[model samples]
Target chain A: MKTILESIALTKIFKTGKIEVTAVRDVSLKVPEGEFIAIMGPSGCGKSTLLHLLGGLATPTSGRVLVDGEEISSGKDAVRTDIRRRKIGFVFQRFNLLPTLSAQGNLEIAQEIHRNGSRDRQHVDEILNLLGLEKKTHHKPSELSGGEQQRLAIARAVINRPAILLADEPTGNLDTRNSMVVLKMIQELNRALSQTILMITHNPEAAGIANRLIEMRDGRIVSQQQEGEWNAAEDRMSL
Target chain B: MSSQLILSNVVSRPMRSLATALAVGVEVALILLLVGLSTGMIRENSKRMSGVGADIVLQPPNSSLVLAASTGAMSVKIADLVSGIEGVKAVAPVYLQLNTSGGLGLVWGIDQESFNGITQGFVYREGRGFQGPDDVIVDDIYADARELRLGEEITLMNRSFRIAGIVEHGKGSRLFIPLGTMQRLVGTPGQATMMMIKCHDKSDIPGVKAELEGRLKSYPIFDMSSFAAHLEEANRDFGPIKFFTRTVVFIATLIGFFIIFLSMYTAITERTHEIGILKSLGAPQGYISLLFLKEALVLGGLGFVLGLGLTFGGRFFFQLLMPTLQHQLPPEWLLYTGILALFSASLGALYPALRAARQDPIEALAYE
Candidate 1:
């Protein structure tokens, strides 16, 4: 499979006054077309920062990121923003749907930001139906339940038919049932819609559904487990 | 997306939006009233003075060059001196005063014989001219408005006088009594407001005007054409008044500007999280800034509409109460006010839009 996204030797540093903190250090990763991958880590382990760097939402302090082999990691704001608009969709852990807009409004906004002709009403309706948000399309973010909001955010992320979907803790705010529903919807998008997805999660169960799982500790990937490899590792650890 | 975002923000805070619009409306109305009243005065004065039909008009030194009000201070004496000049045909002594009962009305007193001799262009509609010291000739429009007719009695300066005749329109005044009666009535027995001079021939006007100017340096001599030009020049006196009004307009605009600025700034500040979400969705800075700008522009448009309503309503009531003040609500004024409202609103939104554009996507999304 062609590599849809790749990050090489990416490092991010935070400088507050006289103090310097290294958030992400020398991380290299690749995601192939139509692949579903999850990165699991403890708090402050730089999972979110890595996701941002991959999605072109932030310029890495050093190294670079590629989308379809096009370097997009280090550039001006407009360049990165343009690449993000063309190729990336983001779903945050907090379900970052615009509270002022309805479910459909959020999806429409995504298509509009894409600046392409992908904002077909029929396609939007079909996606909403697939996400089971057809009945809740007119509801605001606040009006929807936690699980519904997460699903709407996911629908918005993919509405533009982006090259890749970058989700950081997509189900972190949902309950157990909601988390399962959201994870299943994400898996459906990855398999049925052939969407390339990179998700960050702290839950091993959430990582279980991914085709591949990469575990991180203290800002470094400890090991990568493929399909069934994660389940095997979990079983071995439990024993 | 830009339009939808703007509409949502505006609709979300209906009260704040209305207040900002109303502030703009008030500023526009202030400009309309101030500019309209001054324009009305200039236009009306030119109309009345142009209708006089005299070759030359002479007035007291300090009075308006064309309106010819005497203030009862100029001696009826100027009429005699001007009449004795070469080629002088008629010298009509007239006393003009502002009536206390009505608006800035002129109460004119004329000598019937000499005033009638010149083709003053007044047509009598009913009855005869003034026959007694107590008889007055009233204007046709004033008669119809006040429901007055020939032989009807009306009080002037506490004195009851009969309306001996009704005259046609364009005579510049409603109440017309005998010149001697007006001089005695206003307690200035030998004073006249101004003298309307007619030469024996149209060619003799220049000589007569020159002679009058040379003899009475305290008085100004203006032929009909020059009088119109003089009035046009006098229109410049409104410059300071207009400047003062414009200063007030600027202050009013500032109030509207600040209202929109503060409200939009605070609103954007409160919505920083939403901005972050938009940015994460691949929305650009221009898009976010345009959202706030369009919102401000809409508020300005609303304010302009409200201001126009207020201006027309206020003009109607003001005219109803004071019939003498002419308010010409020019169409261009409305257009100008509308444009200014939009411009000011946009100006107010600029800072906030820039601030919104500069918001960091990560920091904004991370905002709680």
Candidate 2:
């Protein structure tokens, strides 16, 4: 399989009042096309920071991140932003959808920012249907339930058909039923569209749905496991 | 695509800020209109004074006020002496009598041939030239008020003359009659109030003024160009009134500025988060600034239109209420309105545009 994203010795250090804290330390990661991977970590383990770095939202202090075999981080700020817009899509823990726009308008805004003119109601409807959000197209984020708003954010993230969808705590605010629905949709999108998805979550059960799982502790990956093994342990824990 | 979305967002939000901007714009426009009207009046007066056909005015010393007040005089003999001056194309001696209305009315006695050579026949709405030595040409205002018309005989200074025509002059009410007849009626044969001189060379105004002033130092010699300067001097003479009007305009514009600033500041505050959303969505800082500018310009434009209409309408209404408002239209209206629109828009947008442009995308996005 062709590697869609590769990071070599990715490191990030943040300064907070006379101390330099390592958020991600010399972390190297590889994500292939059509792969579903989850990065599971305890609180402050830098899983979200890793995802942000991979998504081009922040620059790594010392490392290289390549998307589709292209080195985007070495160029100017404008070029990095363009790559972020064209190649990567992000889903935040808080949904981050503009409260003023309706669900449909929110999706439209994402498409517009990317300068994708082929977007239409039909495309929006298809994504909404996939996420079971067809009936709530006109609803504002404030009016929608937490689960629905998260689903809408997911729909918006994948609407541009990015090479990779980076979701940070995609279902952190949802109940078990809604979380299962979102997991199934992410799985289906990966299988059907050959889309690579990198999701971050602390829930082992949530991580169990990915094809592979990497566990992190103290800004370093400590373990890697297949989906079957992770699921079996999660089932045992639930029992 | 980003620009279109930003525009839609800005337009969709409706609040008190928009109303305040519109109000500021309206006030700015009204102020512009007022300034335009005043400047227009000055320009119109200048035009009428310098317009072709009326070349010279003869009067007693301090005749600027006298002509404005329509008082004082020069003997008829001076008119005859000036008529013989070289390059004196045509001459008409004028006599004046103050009426009960407190306005000066000219009793101009001209030889039929010399008058036609010098003064262009007044633009008459309803009449013809003097038919005989006893006939007269009255002003439109005086004729309209008194219900007099052409061929109707009227008495001035106890002499009856037929109303030959009703005329329009930019300055004052005037009645034209035959020279011999006017001299007999006013008891001043071969002696006139003042003479109107028409020169052969329009460019030789300085030479004529010098020659005439030197010859008639006892009397006042006013060329047409001097009237414009005299009007400026007159305006300067009423120093307090000029200062007061300027100060009032400045205060009114400053008030407009404050209203615009408050409106824009509130708008920026309310939209800080929205602005962050836009920036995160990839809107450039310049585009964000443009949005605020567009709002200010819209407000200014609407206000200017409203104010211009009000000013112009007020001018005509004043003319209707008092007939002396005819002197209030000119080219300066264009200049003042343009300046006011620019001033109001810039004053209103300066701070708001800077604040909007300097907003940080990260902080704005993180705002709750």
Candidate 3:
């Protein structure tokens, strides 16, 4: 399968006073087309930082990030922004949708940013229906429930048909039932649309749904296992 | 969507700020209009006074105040001597006399050609110019008030003269006659009451006055330039009133500026997060600035229209309320007001626009 996104020896360091803290240290990863992969790590393990680097939201201190075989991480701000806008879609835990915009309006803004003509109302309807947001199309963010708002954010992130979808703990703010609903929606998008997804989660159960799982500790990946192998490893660890 | 649509969206969100900006624009425009009107009136009056073609007025010694009052005139020989001086353009000896008709009239005796050139072709509204040597050009207002018409005879200073034409003067009414005719009528054939001198250049005034004064050291030569100086002195005497008017306008403009500034600042603060969203969505800083400029433009346009209506309505009311005061509309007033509205609106929006443009997309997004 063709690699939709690849990060080679990616390193990110942040400075606070005289101390330099490494967020992602020499991390290399590949995300192929039509695959659901999850990065699992403890708190402060740089899982979110890795996701941000892959989405072209932040520059890696040293390394290369390639999207569709094109080196996008080394370009100017405008070029990097264009690459992010055209190729990557992001969903955050907080559901960063504009409060003033309706669910439909939020999707329209994404479509506008991509310069897509005559907003794809049919596509929006399909997404809303798929995510069970048909009844919340005209509702503003404040009016929507937390789960509904998160689903709306997911709908907006995918509305532009980006090459890769990145989620940073998308289900972190939802209840157990809503988390299941959101997980099902993610599964449906990955299976039906064949969308390549890289999700960062601290929940092992959330990571179980992925075809592949990577475990990280202290800013470096410690192990990678296939879905069946990860289940077997979890069973052994439980024993 | 077009940039214009985006601008409309931003402006439409804050209706109260827009209204405040409009009010400021109108006040600035009104003040500008009043100043422009006053300046235009002064200029028009000056031009009309210059058209009378007199550089200096030769009056009797110690009779400066009396001559200004038009109560008496000077001797003619002094006028003849002034006319013989080099750089003297032309001199018309004039006499002022109270008629039996109970009206004040000037009996100016001049050569017809010289009179026409000096007056810039004074048209006779109803009759003809002086034809025979004994003919006179009657003042239009004096003729109208006294029911005097062309071909009628009028007795001035106890001498009869035919009224040949009715002349219009914006300032006041006066009668003109030929020098020979005036001598034939008044019986003062060799004497002139006042010398109206037209100098070659305005700069030659003081020198010519000194020379003429040397020749007639006992007489007083009051230059028309002195009348201009008197007008300037009158304006200086009214300095306090003019200063008060200016102070009022300045205070109003400052209030207008603050009103627009505070309103725009508040509106921008409300939209801080929205602006961040726009910037993160790929809107350039210039585009954001354009949004605020468009709002200012709308406010200025609306205010100009409202202010224009109010000014004209106010002028109409004044005309109706005080029938005695002349209240002609000066076009310069409208032009200046429109310009001032544009300037004030732009100035008022500038600082707020810079602040909005400088907002960080990251910080603004995190503001929530």
Q: Which candidate number has the best TM-score?
A: 1
- Which of the two, 1 or 2, has more lDDT? 1
- Candidate 1 residue pairs in clash (backbone atoms < 3 Å): B70-B193
DockQ of 2: 0.17
Task: Tell me the deviation in Å of residue B163 in model 1.
Answer: 13
Give per-residue CA lDDT, model 1, range A103-189, as digits (tens): 888888888888642456787899899988899978889999999999999998888888999999998899988988999998888
CAPRI grade, predicted model 1: medium
Query: Comparing candidate 2 with candidate 3, which one achieves the higher lDDT?
Result: 3
Name the lDDT value of residue B166 in candidate 3.
86
Model 2 misses residue B91 by how many Å? Answer: 6.6
Q: What is the C-alpha lDDT profile of model 2 across A102-178, one tens digit per residue?
A: 88888887787666444576888888887888899888788998888888988888888888898889889888887
For each model, chain A TM-score? 0.94, 0.92, 0.94
In CAPRI terms, where does candidate 3 land? incorrect
CA lDDT, candidate 1, residue B366: 86
Query: By TM-score, highest first, what's the ranking?
Result: 1, 2, 3
Q: Which parts of model 2 have CA positions greater than 4 angstroms off? A: A72-75, A116-122, A125-139, A175-177, A231-239, B1-4, B11-13, B23-27, B43-80, B83-170, B173-272, B275-362
Task: Report the C-alpha lDDT of model 2 over B117-173, residue by residue, as the tens digit.
Answer: 665656778777777788887777667656776788787666677888877754323
Per-residue error (Å), model 3, residue B351? 8.2
Which TM-score does chain B of candidate 1 obtain?
0.77
TM-score for each predicted model, relative to the true structure: 0.81, 0.65, 0.59
lDDT of 1 by residue, B197-280 (tens): 888899999898888888888886689887866775676355566578678778978888888899789888889998888788
